[model samples]
Structures are given as C-alpha cells and as structure tokens.
Target: MDETASPVESADCRAISEVLSRVGDKWTMQVVVTLSDGPRRFNDLKRRVEGISQQMLTRTLKALERDGMVKRTVCATTPPQVEYDLTALGRSLAEPARRLAQWVRGHLGIIHANRRQYDSRR
Candidate 1:
C-alpha cells in the first residue's frame, strides 16, 4: 500500500490552501476582530485597528464583504455614514479566530524563544 499526503493540486489541499490564503492575511483577522464587538463606523474601525492605513482598511473591508463575512451598511445623513459588522458567517469564524488569538497569547513566550534560537543558529 502506498501512503503519502496529497499534492497541492488535490482537491482537499487546494481547498485548505484557498481558505488559509484568505484567512492568513494580516488585515482580515484584525478586521474580523474589530467588527465582532458591534457595528462600527469606518473611522472607528480605522482607529481600533492601529497602524492600518485608510486605503488598507477600505480594501480589507471590501474583501471581507465580498466573502460574505461582513455586512456594510450606509445610512443617509448629512454626509452619509457607513457602518460595518460581522455577518453570521463572520461571527462563526470569529470563534476560531478568537481561539487562535488566545493560543498565540499563551504561547508567545515560547514562540519568541524558538524564533531567537532559530535566528541565532543562522
């Protein structure tokens, strides 16, 4: 019997890769996290996710909206206000994202030590 993991072209491999490719993007997770609290206006999101540029936030929110993970609402007002929140799918994803966040926090010290060791060897 032959035993080996499937190549990237395999259906499962490709699917997992596609999912991770989007989820692993730095901005996506931050966007999801910030929106988890409740609907937030554009400026609010920009402020909460520090270091993110206006252009990047717009692009990330758009991408998340396209993926069905976020809902964007525009209200008519003096100038118009837009708010963002997680859709059902996005909230579901947040559970895992939150878990991952906790895991990173818990393991940060060990992770940093490992990185130092690896870097020092080279």
Candidate 2:
C-alpha cells in the first residue's frame, strides 16, 4: 500500500490483482479461448489444447468451473460423458482475450527480438 493511498483504492487494487492472477494465467487464457467456440468433451478439449496434460486440463476446467466462468455437464450414457462450456461470464471474457491474443501475435517478433537483445546484454 502506498502511504497516500486510501483504503478503497487498496481494496480495489487487491481485487483486481486477484482476478488478474487467475485471468492472466497462460492455461486459463488458452482454455477460455478454446471454450469460446462451444462446449467440448474432456478428451476433445485435451486434444485441441495440445501440449496440455490430462491432469492439467482437468485442473484448469475445475478452476474455471469454480470461478463461474465455465459450466460442466455430465451426460447420461452407458459411461457418463462430461462436457465443458463457457458460462455467460466466460463468454464475456472471450472478446478481450481474443484481442489480447491478437495483440501478442502482432508483437511477437518484436518481443522476441527485444528479449534476445536484452539477454545478450546480460
């Protein structure tokens, strides 16, 4: 907390920080973007996400579900089938996430060059 900051500002900052910590996570962003298309089964999502392990996918879905950003449904079948979809809140986040991804893609070359330059200087 800054010496001159009011309590309300501090509380707001804390709230923003907490939300950002979740939303800014790489897996969370990727999962949200993937689910933006529509609902997907566990194995399908795992395949589409690429590189994410089954355990990590499970954890990410659980976290999103807990945050009210995703809905999980279990279908009736011989073997229960589970699907994950974005909630309204998750859908709301999709646009901004897409924009951020676009921005990152646009800047990736420059970012890599900057990183390389900085690393070489060190």
Best by lDDT: 2
In order, what lDDT does every prediction score?
A: 0.89, 0.94
TM-score of each: 0.88, 0.94
lDDT of 1 at 5: 58
Off by over 4 Å in 1: 1-9
Compose the digit string of candidate 2's lDDT tens values, residues 1-122: 79799999999999999989999988899899999999999999988897899999989999999999999999999799999999999999999999999999999999999999999999
Tell me the tens digit of each residue's lDDT in model 1 across 1-122.
Answer: 12465564477777888878888889899889888889999999999998999999999999899989999999999799998999999998888888999999999999999999999999
Instruction: Report the Cα RMSD per candidate.
Output: 3.0, 1.1
Q: How well does candidate 1 match the true structure in TM-score terms?
A: 0.88
In model 2, which regions exceed 4 Å deviation?
none
Q: C-alpha displacement of 11 in model 1, angstroms?
A: 4.0
Report backbone clashes per prediction: 0, 0
